[model samples]
Target: MRRGDEFAAAIRRGNRAGRPTLVAHLQVREDVAEPPLVGFVVSRAVGGAVVRNRVKRRLRHLMRDRLHRLPRGSLLVVRANPPAASARSEHLAAELDVALDRLLRRRGPDHQARTDGRV
Candidate 1:
């Protein structure tokens, strides 16, 4: 989706769950009725435009490969730390996988707990 205020706001409000490779903060709410989609935030602080673009491209590719594996109806905002800015595509992909794995695992248990309680 196009970058907009709502998307940025959701990123700001999202929960902060981190992995050693990457730290992610996501806010999942029903007001957003769509399935899992992601927005990335990389600022000038990360590096020049070229570096930022490279990081974005790498993450986008990783996301394309992993989106189907993700839980539906979630909005994910991935923020890259300084170390990630200069990372190679493979390293970026691996780090993203680690971050996503952590998030999905956390979500799964919480969802199961809630569902089991409701049953």
Candidate 2:
């Protein structure tokens, strides 16, 4: 959701705080002081413009749905692979869930406590 220079900087940092996956490459940074934002990178290597846009659209939707599970005040960059350019919505959704859970796990025991309503 971040735009302009700030978004570009986050991608350049490329310090993936969470686990990376085959469906997407995630880079999470907590250096920012603002609310959490997300960026998508679907290169030409993945497909034509239409396909790339489609991938971005799907990723955005998945991110919106999973935002609450993510940590606050961080930046997440989701880079799409070539296969993801044409992936179906259901398949992409499943992959997004897996990648998101992996990333969320990096937040450690705090999240577990939150899940159990003990935090």
Candidate 3:
């Protein structure tokens, strides 16, 4: 999560879900022993420095409480869209939930197996 290579790897290998305000990439790794690692990508395309930071902060706060809901060792990267700079926190959170749900559903059997402690 701290390295650009990690972000690139996740974006390259993970499932993706897109919203008007955000895009999410998710990958499941069996090797991690700690909690899920989450990263935010807010490029200048999203806004200026201040706006990007604000969007990143909002995304981080929204993702914090929801981290435990992801499978252990998962890697998640959330990239903010231009509209995200003006989106409200609640709206962002809702979009995040929807995006994550879509991504997880796409890996239905694997997700179910993990939750059932079978994977």
Query: Among these predicted structures, which one has the highest lDDT?
Result: 3
* TM-score, per-candidate, Cα-based: 0.74, 0.72, 0.89
Tens digits of per-residue lDDT for model 2, 8-82: 665665444322322333444544444567788778888898888877888888778776655555566777777
Arranged by TM-score, best first: 3, 1, 2
Best of the two (2, 3) by lDDT: 3
Tell me how far the alpha carbon of residue 99 in candidate 3 is from the true structure, in angstroms, after superposition.
Answer: 0.6
CA lDDT of each prediction against the hidden true structure: 0.66, 0.63, 0.84
Which residue pairs come into collision in candidate 2? 1-38
Model 3 TM-score on a 0 to 1 scale:
0.89
Residue 86, model 2: lDDT of 62
lDDT of each residue in 51-74, candidate 1, tens digit only: 888877777788887766544456
Clashes of each: 5, 1, 0
The C-alpha RMSD of each candidate to the native structure, in angstroms, is 4.6, 4.1, 2.3
lDDT of 3 by residue, 8-117 (tens): 87799999999999999998777765667889999999988999998988899898878766777778999999999989888999999999888778777746556321
